[model samples]
Structure formats: C-alpha cells, structure tokens
Target: MRFTTPLSAITLMVASVKAAENPIIGLVDRITSISQDFDNALEDPNPVRIIETLPHLAYDGANLVATIVSDVTGWKNPLDNDDQLKTCATLKKFATTEEKLLTAILNDVVKVATLPLPIGGLIGLVASALKEAVDGIFGFSVKIAPVCSDAANKDKAALTDLIANIKTAI
Candidate 1:
C-alpha cells in the first residue's frame, strides 16, 4: 500500500493509532458494570457460590483498570482532568463493594475450614478461589498504582487517596 501524499500517510497512521487506543468514552459504563456485578455476587446467600463468582468478576475488573492505565501511560488519548476525576469517583464507589466481597471470601474460608465433615474437593475449590482473588487484587493494584504515581492530572490528590483506599480495600 503506497500513499500518493505524505499528508495522507500521516493521517492514516494517526487514525489507526487512535482506533487502537483504549476507548475512554465507555470507561465509566464498564466500571459501573463491574461494580454492579460485585453487588449481585454479594447478594448470594451461599458462601461457596459467592466465592465462585468473585474471582471471575475481579479478573474482569482488573483487566479494565489495567487497560485504562496502559492508555493513560502510553499517551494514547489520556482522560482529561474532569474524566480522570470522574473515573476515580466511580472507582471509589466500586471499592466499597469490592471490600465487602473480599471480606466475605475470607469469612467463607473460615466457615469451610470449621465444617464437621470436609466435603470432597471443597478445600481445593476454596484454595483456588483465594489464589485467583489474590492475583486479581495484585494485578489491579499494580496497574492503578502507576496512574496514581503519575501526577499529571489535576485530581492527583483525590486520585492518590482513592487508589490508597482501593489498595487497602482488598
């Protein structure tokens, strides 16, 4: 493929780059979906069922956060100051529910441990869930830490505090 003009080639390159970058437009919606999922997962009365759902949700949540952080760091249509603040606000709200789910997982582990008769495979299942939860939390924090560390946004103070709260939550 050969462009007849340098300007056309440059235009095409810029267009492709923009298309490849993470779409900031739907960030809040994705965050909202994850947050809602967390809430729904917590409503389950069965501890084991809750444990089963949490790891998958956390994985999805962490991946979204990682994608956003990557876009911000790579200078690929980074969120504006207002959008950054909004994103953090949504995240802060999400963190509370996340903390609840994490806490529930811990409590479930204890409950399973104290059962009179150990159900076959229950221990292994709980262990896998715990491992996945830890991995997801670590991945999320690692990505979010960079966003907080880079002080380019006007909402750095709030963002930093929010990130700290999130880190503590899990």
Candidate 2:
C-alpha cells in the first residue's frame, strides 16, 4: 500500500510538471511569433506603415500575455462573475502591466530603427548601435541580425522561416 501511494504521487507530480510546461511553451511560441512579425514588418518597403501599426500589435501581444498569465496564475476576483465589470477591471490591470511591457518593447524597436546614419562607412555601426539601443530599452538582449548579411539576407522570408522554427521548437 505504501509503495503504491509513493508511485502514484510521483506520477501526479510528473503530470503537473508537464501541464505547467505547456503554458510556458505556449507563451514562448507567442512571443517568438510576435517578434518575427515585427522583424518582417521592418523589412517592408513602407516601414512607416509598419511603425504606425505598432500600438495595435503591442496591444494584441499584451492581451495574449495577460490571458496566459491569468490562466497560469489562476487569478480570480470576486467581481469576476460580473461580466462587464470583470472585463473592465481585468483590462485596466493588464493595460497597466503587461501592456506597458509590450509597448516599451515595441517603442524600443521603433527608436532603434529610426536612428540616423551619419555616413556611408557607418551603416554596420548604425545597426550595432540600434541593437544596443533595443537591448537597453527592453532590458533584455535582442539579437538583431543585419538585414544585408548572409544569415538574414532575405529579411521577410528569413523572419518567416524563423517564426516557423521557433514555433517548432516550442
């Protein structure tokens, strides 16, 4: 009886770990997809349009993150049963937190992309500067491959491929 109880407990623990990993994997996949979309947008001929769309994209990203957090954290307010008030409260909270993070990251990307190049010789230097600026703004190291380089030469296509790869990884 004792041996059976211990074995059942170990099985339950393993199942819980697997369940926890699914949400984490989903979050990582969503972030990677959003990153790739942003990168592809950067490569568009009308980058200004892409920049203008950042807020909407950021909001969507934030919503996804908040939903994931709510699921993982099992957050429930007593008012949650009241549909309208619950949604408004949740949105307010999410906007103040996850939305802010998403907006910051998006704004950082825009700032980096808008930096002026001083001279012809400093193109690569500018890209490096942009990378560092993004890192600083996001408080995380953002790996931005040069658009002209072999690794990321086909910018939009490469980003698409990368998104697929990241999704597969997750």
Candidate 3:
C-alpha cells in the first residue's frame, strides 16, 4: 500500500503536468498574455514605448501561427512557420512608416479584439481562425472598417483588408 501510494501520486503529477503542457493550451495562455500586454501598452501615454512592445507581440503572434501550422503538419513550428515571422517584419515596417497612426490602430485593436486566439483548421478553415487570431493581432482598427464583432458572424465583416494581408503573410 505504501508503494502504491507513491506510484499513484507520481502518476497524478505526471498527468497534471502533461495536461498543463499541452501546446494548444499553451497557445491559448500565450494569446491572453499578449492581449494583456497590448492593452496595457495602449494605455500608456507614450506611443514609442508601445512601438517597442509591438515586435515582441508580433513575434509571439508568429510563433502562435507556427504552432498552429505545426499542429496540422507534424513538423516543428520553426520549419513550418507559414510566414508568420515575415508578417512580424512587415508590421515593423508598417509601424515605422507611421508610428502615430499605427499606435492608434493598435489601441483600437486592444480595445475591441476577442481573446483566446481562435484556431480553426489552417487550410480550408483559415479564414475563421485567422480572423480570430491573426486578424485580432494585426487588424481591426479605427482606420479600418467594420470594427469588431463575433468571429462566426456571417453578415458582419470580421476581417479588414489589413487582416487578410497579415493573415496571408503569416
């Protein structure tokens, strides 16, 4: 009974750890973290500070895309990035062109985006997932149209052209 007790305890620990370490679960946590960071940055008075935060946010976002693609392809996320990193670079470039406007856009995004970063199938279901994840990260701003709505809503435009462009890059 003593031996069995220790073995059961170990098994429970391992199972709990495994459940917590599930990559999709990790992905969801990461989404919430980035959303909080972006929201906090938006509240700051300085937009340059916000710019500093954007790259890291974008990279994490890329990693999320990579993770999703990897889930589908069985390759490591590093290999099957689906251009998520490139999308980050593009965002950096876009920010450089107009920091003030981009900052406002990001603020709007933080204000309106739904969280937990959707993960629809990457191939045919790309639109829904990207609309929720990629678009949430990089689209839906005051400058862009439609603002925010339910991801599954058919009548409302969930993603702007910017959203589509970023999703394409990723």
Candidate 4:
C-alpha cells in the first residue's frame, strides 16, 4: 500500500508537469496550423474555396499573433536552446506561409478582375483586406526573426529594447 501510494503521487506530479506546458509553444503551434490552412486554401483550384477560407484565416491569424505577442511580452524566463530554436523555426514557417499567401492572392486578384464590375470589385476588396492582414503578420515575423534567433545567443540589450518598443507600440 505504501509503495502504491508513492507511485500514484509520482504519476500525478508527472501529469501536472505535462499539463503545465509552455504557452508560447502552443500559441506558435496554433498559428502554424492557421498558416498551413492558408497554404492549403491557396493550393486548392476552386476559387470559392479560397474565398471562403479568407475571413476565418484573417480573423484567427491576427488574433493568434496578438495573443502570442502579448504572452511573449509577459514571459520572464529565458527559453532554453531547444525551445528557442523550435520557436524560430515555427516563426519562419509562418512567415513563409504568409509570403506565399500574398503572392497567391495577387495572382488570384489578376484572375478574378476580369469578371463583371460588381462581383470583381467585391472580390478585389476582400483580397486587398487579406493582403493587408498578411502584410502586417509578415512584417511582424520579419522584424522579430532576428530578435528571436538572437534570444539565447545575444546580449539582453537588444531583446530588452525590442520588448520596450513593442510595449510602447501596443
């Protein structure tokens, strides 16, 4: 009975530790999933499918970015090397997806523009809005890449200044 009690307690402790995962990793993963969805939508040949996917992607992607940035600002502990690399890799994937999405949207705009004025115009507006959102996210990823990569390797001054600038911007 005594041995069984200790084993059960250890099991509970392990479960609790696993449950308390790093929030940033989860946020990055979610954003990455959104990014992949954007990629898949762009890859689809059906224009309707692409259009249908845009609103959800825009809303979710923007919110996720905001959430991640907010969480990062609040984080006090420095990430270990493994986590730092994982985060940077995911961010790179996200930026790449955004870049691809922007290019695809531009191509789609050219294709859709030949339609009659009203429908074409509406699509153009949606495309523009999506592009704007992608631009914001892409620009953020580009700006942060260096800072994120240098997180563990570099001195604190650069990262500190970046956080201060972000807080001011927010």
The prediction achieving the highest lDDT against the true structure is 4
Residue by residue across 68-154, what tens digits does model 3's lDDT show?
555445523331243333333333433343233333444455442333322111211322333355333333211122222222122
Over 4 Å off, model 3? 1-23, 75-170
lDDT of 1 by residue, 1-170 (tens): 11113443454455446433323324433443444454454455666765666566556655656655665465534355565564455445444544454445444444444544333243333233333333333333334443532332333233334334333333
Q: For candidate 4, lDDT tens digit of each residue in 51-138?
A: 6665666666556556545654565565566655655665555455444544454454455445432334334333333334333333
TM-score versus the correct structure, for each prediction: 0.38, 0.33, 0.37, 0.43
Q: In lDDT terms, how accurate is model 4?
A: 0.45
Q: lDDT of each prediction vs. the true structure?
A: 0.43, 0.35, 0.37, 0.45
Better of 2 and 3 by lDDT: 3
lDDT of 2 by residue, 71-121 (tens): 534523222234333333322332244333333434444454454522222
Error of 1 at 104 (Å): 14
Tell me which residue pairs clash in candidate 4. none
Let me know the TM-score candidate 1 reaches against the reference structure. Answer: 0.38
Model 3 TM-score (2 dp): 0.37
lDDT of 1: 0.43
Tell me how far the alpha carbon of residue 35 in candidate 2 is from the true structure, in angstroms, after superposition.
0.7
Task: List ranges where model 4 is wrong by over 4 Å.
Answer: 1-25, 32-53, 117-170
Cα lDDT for residue 83, candidate 3:
38
Give the residue spans of candidate 2 off by over 4 A. Answer: 1-21, 75-112, 115-170
